[model samples]
Target chain A: MPLSAAAPRRPQAGNRAYLFITPFLVCFVLLFLLPLAYAGYLSLFKDQLVGGTVFVGLDNYLRAVQDARLLDGVLRVALFFLIQVPIMLLVALAVALAVDSGLLRLANMFRLGVFIPYAVPSVVAALMWGYLYGPDFGPLTQLGERLGFAAPRLLGDSWMLASLGNIVTWEFAGYNMIILFSALRTVPVERYEAAAVDGAGPWRIAWHIKIPALRPALLLCLIFSVIGSFQLFAEPNLIQRLAPTVIDSSYTPNLYAYSLAFTSQQVNYAAAVSFLLGFVILVVSYAVLLLTTRRPRR
Target chain B: MTTTIERPRSRRRTAAGSHVARRPRSERRSNLLTLGMGALLVYFLFPLFWLVIAATKNTGDLFSTFGLWLGEDFSLFSNIQATFTHNHGEYARWMANTLVYAVVSAVGAASLATFAGYGFARYTFRGRGPLLGLILGTIMVPTTALAIPTYLLFSKVDLVNTPWAIILPSLVSPFGLFLMWVYARDAVSDSVLEAARIDGAGELTIFFKVTLRSLVPGFVTVLLFTLVATWNNYFLPLIMLNDPSYYPITVGLSSWSAQAVGGNGSNAELLASVVTGSLLSIIPLIAAFLLLQRYWQSGLSAGAVKE
Candidate 1:
């Protein structure tokens, strides 16, 4: 329905509407806005022995620009995003299309089975995968030995990112698929009938009709996936126990800020790092929004 | 226009019906799709399957036996007993903590979202557009980036290390509010509100008596989403709470896994408990997801398709 048709006629409760919104606005300001403003406030100062807490005026952010560890962590997650998100989204798209195709039997079972992982906490998922990735006694290694060849070191320095990516993909692909699948369900049946009458097969119809219609939903998934990529933490943080040599304190930007504040007690610099990370996310998310939405114009 | 509320179900039926009508000519293609789905299913389910199997084995069997098959001994019951009874029943405490945090946050967040969403949808007020824009804008901010500052702010107020730290931040869910805004715009009609007002009902009464009934599905959807999010939350609690007693199952299990791997050799026994605890922690959530599958799926469609 067009939104204008649904616009409220005259302000029935006008200012009284504040009564309903007050509760949310209260929490929003206290929990979200206050901390955000405080973080900005906290970022400008430095705790130095001589001054005991002097306003440094963006010194932390200046240091962040030149900080090798922070830069490396950002690059690492950017690479992770480039490689993992496409593979994950493609898998989710394929599965969602397959389920929507009506060719699969017990589609709901497949849907639920895939979505079950999403319900499992990331902490649990990480631990389960960690146990399976155990070098000496993990199931994969034992299976490899039984098959008479040494298995590749999944938790080794060389493959840790890929291993982390796999776990993330395993956890979230089903969720993206569900989003796409529901979007598919909302397509009017008349569209399919029109395509069928035109002699298009299912594959052709899917490629031409369904996929094009899925652009907005796909864009939604892409933006969320981008945000998730930047905020990568729990999997690496948990798996750090098993592979300490490979994953360091600054493994991801979020992890970097975490250790800086909690372990190193550098709350000032950590606040700066977090603000920069949040800024990066906003810029990238906006860029994605522009790029995806711009394409349809041509 | 009343059909707007019922549209999702009817649309789903037509979508499913169309597929059945086209089934006869695609028998060969159907087999291929089925095979593809079967492989995807295994990829999705294998880790969960491994978790369940590993939870059934003793610590020795976890390493010594074939990872896929049953161990020499059936230690499932013993494993459950040990998981719950370990470390002075810490696992149970964590579970209780998680349940309280999740339930309270879900109810509060959903209720708040409903009222705000309805107010935005059905009533005209000052700052509506800008306020909604700000709320939507926050959704782009990565939550982990906010964790440190939130912790610091909470600490200043002496709310850190308490359940309030976790529950307070969780109660403001931008995505939930956005979902409700879209849902309420369609689900609740202006005419209904107008009639209730003409009959001399107060705004709050109309909401509670009239609007709230129609918004139940959206409320449940937001509730389930927040429940999962709060239950699965790790980073916030890990940083905010220093006391072990306040740990949720996520932080608790991670601590145990750390002990199993990084601790001296004797602490390796916690490995079995970790696996069993991981399995136990997920059962209730998985059950909730499966049972509420329909509501959430519709919720996603309402949010996604409308946008």
Candidate 2:
């Protein structure tokens, strides 16, 4: 990547150069490529009582277009994307800016503390939050009761989605903060001095200079968060055992495909669901990447 | 500077108040920024604090105790014993399984990524552009979407329930390859390879003796990440492994917690065990984080270089 793009490299790799890459390519095909191809192939066939794995052509997709459960799951995850990602990114951007301004004392402490959650496994973090979200004995619930309010129902039907958002934001906001902060570090100090001499205060400086410099990092975080929205399996799936009434088996598309293949034994339909979800994510990521890259970054 | 604010300052101003008056507006804003960052610190660390202390209490006190305060009864020792002894010592087995999976996969992956990364960086080969693009494009695909299909693929080969199911896929990190490629382009110069070639060293010998020496940091970075990832993985193992013995700590802990509260509420005291079990599972990872934090920062920044 450090090599200049306009310059041509002298030929050093012989035909045997592939020998170095063969191992990775082999595993890559078996694990990534083959499974994707197989999922596509599986989606084209439907298991019928009489015909047994008949060619459905576009039939599975046609059903998917009308599948309420899949649509509902998609909508819920989409809602999560709209709400959670922005809030998380904003918080991240704020903290990153605060630290980069050379204003926060013990900045490393804040940075590491915020980032510690990213180190915790999503499962363990979910379980920890799940324990705290318990209505009966959960710390949050009891704390609420003691503070002159009724016990809060975090896992209740209306609040469950928000609760999921809080957990995800807590987990990743720090990570995004670090990414943004790294980009902020690369900004020249002269930019700041120039802004300061213009009588721009800290907030105005952040608004005008630092945030603009963080555009690539912010775009990167946005794309990753979007992909993460579609990949919202672990948090919901792990917490389902806590609130079975609110979180159903097919709570998210990933969970739906999981239950279909493993529990309902509908592998063909499940495969189709997986492919459809993958397609949606691909299109969205491509569009975001396109929109960001199409314009010249200042 | 002091005299400049003296005239405008109020007559009631004390010595420290005059010092504060001497400060620029932005300097005072930094004090507020410090407090704001402190608040963010607590927000991030509070749950981890809760997790640590909650593991110390017996089951009955877990509900009765205040959120932040420690319970009157400290039973962390017994809880640890119970955690290790739970379900006929399945937690220990799960921990062992996790260690095996994380280590094997990290070593395999780092090695493969290093080799592939070196090849991609140093060699100009046919179809490299399209091939690298295809691999880079895979980075956008959700890993969850690939799991079900991957399960289907493994089932055909009769490796679904085995440890290979977990280890095989962990070996194929597109990001790791990309990171190593970037690291190698700068770390390993073309002149060194040419000098080695003129010295009549084989490509493999040159890579092993010359290139690999300079690539330790990249390898270690990849190793640490893959280790953490495989250790924390839940979904793949949940679907892939049905046997209790093969369960990693992630799946095993969830199963334990599920039974502890489990709609039926069969094991009330099991909550203590679950809490303790959760604490033990993350201790190694947390330790890893604290020890190698610099690597984590560098690893991520290395990834900031995009195509």
Candidate 3:
């Protein structure tokens, strides 16, 4: 009897645990769980001319499947992920390795310098970069002209995505580098010493040892980058105000959802789009984690 | 040492060869890496420096002069004054709104996340793992994706454009919750709680008096993150708030920048104010970082250096 009683837990303590967690669960359900459920509900319906929602059952999902703008947004973000993730992660890794070497003077200063931009608001960073990329009074344009080169229009249709990519990379590279550098510090020094004694160069040692040890952090950074990449909004949205002719209402999925709800007054469709985006993010994020985590096949 | 020098000629040969052989290539590479790092550093820092200089200049100098160079006039005080004064003191109201929103939301989020994290870490419950995975998924699902849905829900409740709409969403930071959970798991032991419980401390008392003290660093990290995130939140407020009077500095300054850009030559003061406003916006962040740097620095190296 005593063993069984102890095995189930002290009901009093279990009750207390329930009591403590109730607040969180309440907030979680009300804010997150409920909204998610509401989104799912909305996803199943369509707008009716009778001023009410009609149950359309999965028609919205089917429409989303064939939606060209959503597809274009996905493809655009795919391009963004391909080009930006490698560049950002490489730079972050290089900086982390350099900082971890313990040989760089003013390391803290450099680290802070790199990380400061991340602390700046994304909108402000976008604005600052937007201004920098502007043709008139833009230092980049003036400098490029002085150097006898054409100042490529950055906010136009051709390069707007790339410009946004630059802003994001600038904003987050330091953050990712900090993550990687911290991971790098955890690496045992003896491994490097052993490699050094074997006449292995820094490149060989880094590739063989540091990179392997940083796998988890690198994975985390990649996961975060994927999440952030797909949620691209503020840069394009803010820039759209200044250059709306180039950046259409559907420049990105989030923007599309925003315009749908607020501008076009298609709340149901926007909710559907939001769910579709959430689903896509979930799928891509899961795939990324699975792909990154799977052991390389022999 | 002397005995080694006498007996180990091979080791000495290896050491000397190691130095001579490894020196040139490593030195050259290090130099090249250093140069590259320097260039990257400049590329990152130059714009911020430009913003600082631009902030000091009046509107006439903003366009007529080089952005990278310093202007002759010093109108930063006037620019800040103008930022506050020009729009019926709406910028000041916006700053106040930002402070209120950021402080309340950040502190609230940190508190909730910490409490939730402690609960998650200390208790055994049904569906815990799945619940945790759900939270982690929430972290990956960009807050932007939820903006419209959240707005729709808020609008249904007639809460759009209000502080609650922004504050409510800001309070649920899955990443912050995760951090707190991880921190509490290791930092707060069951025995400590047991001792506290045995000493007649209630759960609230134990959490506030004991657990929170140990979790100060995590709290600071979360607070800083929430502060930066909430303060810089543009899209949420952009969609939520229709009134310019309720705009946070980011949106306010963005609108100012756009309007100034559109106004052509006459809106130089507004442009100058925007520049000044941009510089001002960074001060709190820099100050917070410097003041809370020990926490920030320690937060990075905490789980990082542990093998």
Candidate 4:
């Protein structure tokens, strides 16, 4: 019985098996583990003129707690997460649901069209959108002028962040759709057949059947978006040059870390900021995961 | 009971105009759905279409002409020439740099992820559970969160500004590992490995002779993931690199755009080049996405749903 139980598993090579994992373990130690430890270690010190880098022991965290620049960036991304994630996920969900319904012709083409933007590097997307948002030569501005109205200043201080949101939404709407659509595909055909025999309309079938089955996928996407939304960096940073007055160095937390580290040469302080951002993300995403995940009935 | 259940469904199917009867059937024409889908298609595609058109215009015609329409002049080849030749051939260098970084990192990451994934899937080792958990936990730590500390660490060895700054970090793919772990578990059967072992194949040869063949799909998946991540990377390079020569296409193009604005209309000519360069940078990725789309889509869904 003992041999039979262990039989289903492949031969256990004992210590020799570690060789298979050595390469990734080395990288995992270097890139993932050591950097985190170094970040934590660096966050506890402050570089001073005469004294050199000295241990301040949570003073950096205290300073980060009080820093308005960091707070403003945090709140900005928080607002972004709240507003943009839903809009983006809704559009993605809509597309996924629509395509899964088999109602849309050339569905593969449309799915590909929606997904192609995701292939465009975010830097490229931001640049394209930045050009399109240009007051001088962008199409929308020209259309506005041709229609005898003042053109919208999309990259202006008022609309720049939301404009950044649009770029993000455009980039990933297809990605989330594909994920959700795949989950939708896993739904049993018998369930749909049963619903149809009950004379349920398409809307009813979708609402009660497809969506409930899609709950886990929805939760996964929500968590991914929540995490992604907080880490907004590349689009805003790239768009800043096009709208300098609107996007300061402290526009996003990651951008703030870059500015602090490279421009201000405050590597120690930037390490603190990075950890703080990570901590908040950890707590927030954990809370979302806990609240959203449901226990299966026995 | 069957008749009782069947009568209502038949009645409803007949009454509901055949759309609900069979979702895939094209018997019914729904204008509202067709229109909604068309709008979505435009929303996704209009920017690329604009980019193609924008690439064809010179600085003067780009601004003066209706932005959506073709201009009086076709300067696409000239713009292409300008893009390649701009700033003493820096754009071409950036392209080369990005390609090297992306390809090398992709190969390393895929190989590492597959090896680790296969190990985790097929082995029974000490601390396997905790080690796998630890690897998965790293996914929550965003790359931006790690950038500063990674920089601090990399600078200790003075790797900043060289390709290693980007490529070293890009090689470790937590999500890729996770994907391959699931793939290896499902795809590589235990019986096959046991058979290889009984045939006197060494562990290393078993991996090369048996395991790698089955892991190719997963390896390709991880390769594409890492390739795209490296190719599109911006912040890591923006922080790590100071030299224009080391800049990838993303950072390089951004600096050009910045220069265009900072010069404030004297170098308005640079804007056209920036547009054209952006077009050039994305073409390869778009082509990759279109060609390898089946693998990409299947790979993405497998990773997502398995998670």
The model with the greatest TM-score is 1
Per-residue lDDT value at A78 in model 4: 93
Clashing pairs in 2: none
- Candidate 4 structure quality by residue, lDDT tens digits, B199-304: 9999889999887876776677788878988999888998899999999999998888887767445477898999899999998888887888656555555555
C-alpha lDDT of all candidate models, in order: 0.88, 0.82, 0.77, 0.83
- The DockQ values of the predictions, listed in order, are 0.66, 0.51, 0.39, 0.49
- Model 1, residue B281: C-alpha shift (Å): 0.3
Clashes, model 3: 0
Summarize candidate 2's per-residue lDDT along A136-214 as a digit string, tens digits.
8788877788788887589999999999999999989988898887666555556665765666666777899878777
Candidate 4 TM-score to native: 0.92
Candidate 4 Cα misplacement greater than 4 A, ranges = A1-8, A294-298, B1-30, B263-266
- lDDT at A159 for candidate 1? 93
- Pairs in steric clash, model 4: none
TM-score of chain A of each: 0.96, 0.91, 0.91, 0.92
Best-first order by TM-score: 1, 4, 2, 3
Query: Cα miss at B92, model 2 (Å)?
Result: 0.9
Query: Which portions of model 1 show Cα errors greater than 4 Å?
Result: A1-8, A296-298, B1-25, B263-266
lDDT of 2 by residue, B1-307 (tens): 1121222222312322333345466567778889878887888888889988998999988878886779989989999998898779999999999999999999999999989988887888788777877887887888888898999888978999999999998899887898787767667778878899899998899999998977776788788889988998888999999998999988998888788777764787888887788888888877887898655555555455333
TM-score result, candidate 2 = 0.91
Better of 2 and 4 by DockQ: 2
